[model samples]
Target: MEKSLIKPFIAKRVAQEFTDGMVVNLGIGLPVLCTSFLPEGIHVTVHSELGIVGQGPAPDEANADPMHIVDAGGSPSSIVAGGAFTDSAESFGLIRGGHVDAVVLGGLEVDQEGGLANWIIPGKRMPGMGGAMDLLVGAKKVIVAMEHTAKGNPKILKKCRLPYTAINCVNMIVTEMGVMDVTPEGIVLREYNPEFTVEQIQAATEAELIISPDLKPMA
Candidate 1:
């Protein structure tokens, strides 16, 4: 598949990480796509930092509610049954209190040490981070969903040159190229994308990686 197909591919893989009865925070952008690909038979409570919970996929053109319903990115969305709305303080309270089971966030750079740099790009003036820093510190599991490289540059780096969003907080990485886990030993390659060779992925990654003994293709 082409690079344009990577985000949703990674999002689908990230969706598999959720289990039944879990409260998950899906960050803006690509992470939001996971809501549309969640596996059947599992009940997940989706949280948005903009103060909404139990959000479903983006609504169709006819069903879109312009005034009241949306995700943090301001995209039109649907709310599930029994969903509740609250203020940002309360929303972050749930996150900071560790009530969240997992958080899937987009990333610009991730280091072998599990450090993340997603907020700023140095020299560019971007809006401040909404709640990613809080989510990184408090979520039980921090998963990053991004492409393996950016403009042909490796995003999995030996060390992030951009400003750090959170240090040593990432637990797993889901990229279009594969899925990897951050282990005490090193970054362990758990699965490889069938379309790409291990050598190709290794060549694209700047960090030292250890392929798992039982490595397989991503489901």
Candidate 2:
């Protein structure tokens, strides 16, 4: 698949993990795209650390209320009916208090043991670790959604090279190349992109993968 199509493909697959009435939080960038691909008839109440709950979709740029409604990334967004805006403290309380069902976060690297390192790269200036640390531990399920590789370098590895945001916190990983479950034995390849062979996928990942007997094509 073309590079341009990868993010959305990964997002669509991640969206499949959400069920109706789930309260999900999406990290900035790629993770936020999952909102655009949720399965039909599913009603997920999206949360934004920026203090919005029941978050809706991005609005038409021409009609967007930029100053009043925006996601954590500062992109214009809409709020669903009955959605309420809260103070930052209360918003974070919802996360730290474990009120969230799941959180989809973008990652720089994920390891076989489900370690996640996404907050920063060594010596690179970063604002700080945002809500990731809290969400990873507080949410019921944690999903890492990212590209399979970065400039042809595997982002999935035997062990994460960067500082971890949380250890053994990830439940699943969704990338354009496949869907993997981080399990006790290893990273299990539960679904794969039909365009690539198992060897090809393995070559793109530094972590050893255990192919599932029930492995199926990633749609």
Which clashing pairs does model 2 show? none
- TM-score between model 2 and native: 0.93
Per residue, candidate 1 scores C-alpha lDDT tens digits across 1-219 of 686788889999999999999999988789878877889997799988788888777789999997888788777878788988889899889898998999999899999999999998757857787788999998999999998998899999989989999998999999998999997777999999999999999999999889999999999
Please tell me which predicted candidate would have the highest lDDT against the true structure: 2
TM-score for model 1? 0.92
Q: What TM-score does each of the candidates earn?
A: 0.92, 0.93
User: CA lDDT, every prediction?
Assistant: 0.90, 0.92
Give the distance in Å from residue 107's predicted Cα in candidate 2 to where it truly belongs: 0.8
Model 2 agreement with the true structure over 18-115: per-residue lDDT tens digits: 99999999998898888788899998999988899999888998969998998887889889999999999999899989899999999999999999
Error of model 1, residue 20, in angstroms? 1.3
**Angstrom error at residue 141, model 1:** 0.9
Weakest 10 consecutive residues of candidate 1 by summed lDDT: 121-130
Candidate 2 Cα misplacement greater than 4 A, ranges: 60-67
Residue 191 accuracy (lDDT) in model 1: 97
